[model samples]
Target chain A: MTLNNFIRIFITIIFANYINSKINFFITDYYLNFTLGFLVFSYWVFTLEEHLYALPSFCIGLSIDLLSGSPFGLNALLFSISSYIIHSYRYSFKIFSFLQVTIFFAFLSMFYLGFIHIFMNTANFSYLLIFLSFFLNGIAWIFIYILMNRFKKIFYK
Target chain B: MARIAPGNTPKLGYFVLIILASLFLYLDIQYKTFTSTKNFFNAGLIATNLAINNIVFSPISNLYKLTNNKLALINSNELLVEELELSKSENFLILNKDKLFNDNSELYKFINNISNDYPHEIATISSFDTNLYKCCDNHRLHLFNNSSPFKKGGTVINSTGIIGQISDSNNKVSEVILISDINHSIPIKSNAFFCNASGSGRPKVLECKYDPSLWKESFEIGRIFYSSGLGGIFPEGIMIGSIISIENVEDGDILLNIKSIANPLTQKNVIVLYPNDIK
Candidate 1:
């Protein structure tokens, strides 16, 4: 990758980290998964960039693990698997419109929450929260895509 | 030449891997052998947290500098001075013979006595897994506070109420199990009855199982519950939560729904209480 691409990636990672901390309000108690997971997962899938996805996912998941004091590989493993699954399907996914990506991400997010629930054996989880998170993820992904698209054109062009 | 189709081997391999990983996770949880693996992952987690903190600190610090004004700063200083003087006068009242009825010293002594009873060291909570069902139990509490005298299995608290017990302790950090964890149970009581209030691991919900025959009518909604001191985990009289509702089950047990007063998300600073009598 060129220097410009490197900087763009770095900035994305930084922005992703900021969001990870700020979005704790939504995820801390009700959702075990980070709200940032939705954003990060979307970013990787939309970019269709496989190589760049894993490290960031690991780093971000690890950061959350430390912040919340959870078992070490738990998040790293979850995030990596989530990103990889999304990455595998990136080629087939039609991302021409925001709504399409939103619907796609909503389904994937269920896997995320479901994985956590099964892992923790927690009961009475609100499906509404999962649905809300999917909606929030859609909004977040679209906004970030627009910003990142702009950055890519300005700097990479 | 004829057309060729892609083999299904890759897809099948991926599925097999997932199934294997799932089984490994289940076994790890059942056998409790993932501690070392968790610690290794935790090292990476700590590094990531530090990096994020460093990145965010600059912008937050810049914002603080941008908004700070001399007048506001001076007012804060003056308020601190006044608060210091007021405490000094309160201290003087405790020392004087004429004001012996108040006995502020006795209050201080009581507090001191309790402090001595449960000597603690500070630990910063690092992370918690919110997932409810992993067999090896993916839930863990990482903390940065390491100098705590209490080891793993020691109890933690804040000024308002009990936080959780210690699950893991290291040189510079410790992990605490929040009262919301299914693994934790504290013996609790009210003014009229006593029972064990178990954490449901669901936020804001606790279960108090009391014998239906004993003081069943006395347990009312909105009544406060306190630590009964029977579990040896918590000190007596610390507020747990209020009784939200009560239900009598066919099993002849009364279940009290307790809504925890402590909000762990907001309460960061906690005291890790270590009993003096730990053998």
Candidate 2:
């Protein structure tokens, strides 16, 4: 990626992490966790042609792991695997309807939540949390998508 | 230009990176290989946070306070009120020294030096994830000690009671593993029965499991728990918490859920007392 794109993605990732942390403070009372940062990362990788490289994805994951209390490389592993998955299905995603893609991302987020919980919070794992987070994350993604589109239009114009 | 699909992208590159990440995750979970790296990062983060608070927030708040002379006076007055509150907490420790250490005279000898003026340094809460504190098992908080360095294993207390002990220290920032943390355990007693109460991973709750057949005394709710001083970490007879509930487990052992008296989130300023210092 060019330096400009690299800087932009880096800032977006950090900002997303910050927002996730702040939002989690309120939503955890309902046993709901939104993997906003991971969703943002996935969204960017799917939309941007310049975001296909696994190295940048890995580096971003490491940055997230550092910022979060999660063990090192947890995000790194997930992000790299996610990049591979997204790249493999890039063509299929083009033909898929918006609702189908949203559901797919929601399932991806549920997997992310379950995987992180196994490693970090095995004692308090609730199936309810996974069930609830899927729908919340799907809605969150829709909002993020619309907001990003509006921001891009304003920027490009 | 269309984005490269996985089938079109170099497959070997992604495989190598995934394998590398797996190795990192394995090493980190197995051996805690990245602890020092994380700690270093945390220390830097704490320092940066402190700098930002001082450079930006403090000045803005100070200027806002300075807008009105009455507000400035009230601010100074609030500072005095805080000092009074701190001393009142210290006084509680001093007055209760006998009650707290009546059973263990050895511990009493150490607490005798708790002076009237200021016996301990006040540490302020630096970064506490109230979200994790409420929802997660790993309950810990970062405390910024601007005065003397904090002693690891020092008892951290607020006006209410014993909160936790210092688990780790990085420069002036220390980590306190709260009694609610799954890894933390404290020896607590009520009247005749004594047991090690482990963190329930629920906020302000500690669990003490005992074989029902072993102890003759029937445990009831609202019974106050006191520090047994078996671990020598906390002062003896200091009120830890009260029994809130009881549960019979599968193994025929009864679990007593004690609601801790001290809530870490309630008090931003805490006093760290090193019992070993006087010893």
Best-performing candidate as measured by lDDT: 2
- Cα lDDT of model 1 by residue, B189-220, tens digit: 77657777777756657887766566545777
lDDT of every model, 2 decimals: 0.59, 0.80
lDDT for each residue of candidate 2 in B1-279, tens digit (9 for 90 to 100): 234555576678788888888988999989989877886788799889889999999888888877765676877898998888777566666655554543666435645644421146678888887767766777888888665557778788887788888887777578888988888999998889999999987788999999978998897789888888786667667888889999999788898999997888776788877665432
Error of 1 at B163 (Å): 2.2
Spell out the clash pairs found in candidate 2: A87-B6
Q: Which stretches of candidate 2 lie over 4 Å from their true place?
A: A154-157, B1-6, B64-71, B81-85, B92-119, B277-279
Interface DockQ of candidate 2:
0.51
Model 1 whole-model lDDT (C-alpha atoms): 0.59
Task: Report the interface RMSD that candidate 1 achieves against the true structure, in angstroms.
Answer: 7.5
Task: Please report how far candidate 1 places residue A24 from its true position, in Å.
Answer: 4.5
In the range A1-157, model 2's lDDT, one tens digit per residue, is 6777676767777898788888887888788998888888888888886555689888998888888877788999899888888787888888789998899889888998888877777667788988999999999889888876675466422
